[model samples]
Target: MTNTLEALTVPLIQAPMAGGPSNAALAVAVSQAGGLGMLAAGYKTVEAMAAEIDDVRAGTLNFGVNLFVPESDPSDPGRLAAYAAALASMALELGLAAPEPGPFSDDHYAAKVDYLVANPVPLVSFTFGLPSADDVARLRSVGTEIVLNATDPEEISAADALNPDAIVVQGAEAGGHRATHGQAKEPSESSTHELVTLAREYTDKPVIAAGGVTGADIAQNHFDAGASAVQVGTLFLTAEEAGTKEAQKDALLSGQYRDTVVTRAFSGRAARALSNRFTERMAAVQVVGYPQVHYMTAPLRAASADNPEGLNLWAGTGFAACQLRPAAEIVDEFRSL
Candidate 1:
């Protein structure tokens, strides 16, 4: 068997966009096209993740799975209630009940880890926080390659200590949630090329560049800066194999959304999304809750699926360059560039 990084025929990896966009079909297509495809394990149940893992396994073994490492940031009930009140009117306008904040959950982190340990896979990556050294040992013991996401030089040092197979250096230009270790601190604004260089100063571990990677030139820049590969999410959002909702796909190419902002209004944790009504209105009253605020606003997001302004339009700065073609074409295009 080849080392995970060396096995990639193309040095591009499909970013694991959690929620609905990432699916087994997208991963399979990317893998078949010479790049590594990743299934987003965040916001998914163990069984659902297992099914997707099975689906990917049936097609290719070059794919990977990315999990959100659970954090223990407790949400103040009063703050949660206050933010819930802030969203009340919008919920009512959509014929929904006032948003109810749920207790903080680890998103079934332990269960998901156990599942992966029992049924080993090709690769496993983590974000949000570092997994325990024991967990890393167990996974590595099975020959599963481990990768961790880092947003700054400090995070790179921390992840390096755990001895991951590689580190994904996410720049400020990335979309969706900024994978800061905790929900309390703000993310850094370093560019992908800058981060790759900075992280190399801390550790010799291979760095996989992410964020605002729109085309071949940017990918080459990272590789020139000593990056092993470039992980892209925004470019694949519009791929035909992607599960991106129609509303989001239209918003990406509609010319209506030109800018993206990093705000915590939607999930109570800072994330990058197209500036829209929900983010704009809730910006002031935003609270620091993870799954709590995530669940609190679920009904509103679901009810307003047809209304792009009310949904979490997660896209990176390079979203405008996304092409509406098969994922294989997108991966091949990146490889040939």
Candidate 2:
């Protein structure tokens, strides 16, 4: 594992937004602008991730791949059923039958690791949980720099024990799923700056500040707080190269959403999304069954493809400052800070 922060012309890393916002073209553009671009390997097959890696490689080698470590304990079956029942009405609204929960899969974690070992990239990061010691060794043996995400001081201590090259300090304000180590534990509410300072007290590993970073000044504040680099995801959702759906982009740009809240209603894992009809309606009834609840709501989300109010509009608190532009321009703007 290596620290590529010093080699970067812009000490910024684009957060690997797992759903549709992330794409090869967007990653390449950020890398071309002298920042680290990343491919989100979550919710994708091993082959699909490899194809995207190839696409990014075609433009630049300064890139990384992010993956979700498989959940150790399966989500409670009772919770899955309960959540499915709760989503039945939404399914009916979409002219579909009652939602059925599916069996949990490991997200092909082992195979994706194997692929990365065989085709090593400059960096590889893990969210949800840290990989096994042997897995980390194997990836490092191939010259792949490893980064692990941490939400609070306790998680930072856990990540330090793994001895990764760096740690992504994801604050509570981060968009998308909170990278808590286990599904059962409640995530901490430390801000990005506080997390960065807290992490420094535990380890000397590079700290990459993530969450609510909107512009140059905020990113600079993170650096001043001892972060090696700043990672931004929401800011790039509107980039020309992004694969963000039109509904999501329009909702974000419309100024209709005055605030964002962390909700498990959409995916059963705590994620920050703009307040909408789905979040409001299902807030009280949702359960903690990640991929299961995520799948159960899939048909409804697809059926409401054109309606932003029915879908997950993941965004950080700083989303209001987001601008529609090219990925390169976004990275360049952060660099100039």
Q: What is the clash count of model 2?
A: 0
Candidate 2 lDDT over residue span 88-107, tens digit each: 88888889999888667789
Candidate 1, residues 1-337, lDDT tens digits: the string is 1386688788998999999888999999999889999999999999999999999999998889998898756677899899999999998999988888866778788899899989999899998989999999988888899999899999999999999889999999999998888987788988878999898799888889999999888898888899889999998999999999999998998988888999888888889999998888988889888878898898889998899999999999888898789998888767754
TM-scores for all candidates: the values are: 0.98, 0.98
Please list the residue runs of candidate 1 whose C-alpha ends up more than 4 Å from where it truly belongs after superposition. Answer: none
TM-score of 1: 0.98
lDDT of each: 0.89, 0.89
